[model samples]
Target: MAMAVGVVAAPLGLSVISLVNRLQDIFSRVGSHSSIDLPQVAVVGSQSNGKSSVLEALVGRDFLPRGNDICTRRSLVLQLVQIKPSQDEFGEFLHLPGRKFHDFS
Candidate 1:
């Protein structure tokens, strides 16, 4: 259930938040921070079991594409990123380049 994931994710989330804070602190001291490549955590769960709904709620928008019931369509690598000038990306896949995926909701 979601509670299990929450229990496991809470610590990981805190650790990641602390790491980002430390990175920001370090960059601020450097006077000029060009950019940063942040790591991502994959949230794997049963298809259409409210996983997308949960993510959509967290993001406060419906950017992720939906798909048919019988097919996976696309494997999304969900990355929490800042939409700044330097960091301008929602997600990217390792196996594909310049290929953005979409699904039918």
Candidate 2:
């Protein structure tokens, strides 16, 4: 991972510095970013409370399906995705472009 990062950063001189700065910014943004806040939700309840089910429903994905219990003990968060209706004549969903999801949210 370190080698891959270095390879990508070697091409753009100033851009690599900016990338590092952006990573720092993402970590610094606590209250203003929902991307940073969603992971903080604590799914606490009794046995068979459907906490994982609720999370899967909210995120519109199978966050905790069957046979995926090995890594369920930790508090790691899954990636969140957003889809919007197409504005063009032909009906098709358009992706929200760019990497700065914090700005979009």
Candidate 3:
């Protein structure tokens, strides 16, 4: 039944989440000072192809600039972290270390 499947999937999902958190911690400690080559995803398409829109939707935030004109001129590195519900949500930039951006806008 659906309930049995849900019980099995819940633990598997939690295990995956735990693994991701561990990997992120390891990368954070090792890659902060040195150049660590990590996996990347490139979204290539024609102009006005809704690429930015899709990324914003995936992140559940309207952080990307939107207008009729050209918005993004340089390459962007976006890092998304999953946090606990009790923890405060924020964003950080590699250039500006130790500063937490509470507002995405």
Q: State the C-alpha lDDT per candidate.
A: 0.59, 0.46, 0.71
Task: Work out candidate 2's RMSD over C-alphas.
Answer: 15.8
Q: Write one digit per residue (lDDT tens) for candidate 3, span 1-105.
A: 447544544466566656655565677667754364444567778888988887888779888777798897667767676678998888776668899877756
Candidate 1: where is the Cα deviation over 4 Å? 1-47, 68-77, 85-90, 97-105
* TM-score for each of the candidates: 0.37, 0.34, 0.55
Pairs of residues clashing in candidate 1: 66-103, 66-104
For model 2, what is the error of residue 4's alpha carbon versus the real structure, in angstroms, after optimal superposition? 36
lDDT of 3: 0.71
* Residue lDDT tens for model 2, 10-32: 34645554555455445645434
Sort by lDDT, top down from the best: 3, 1, 2
Error of 2 at 95 (Å): 26
Clashing pairs in 2: none
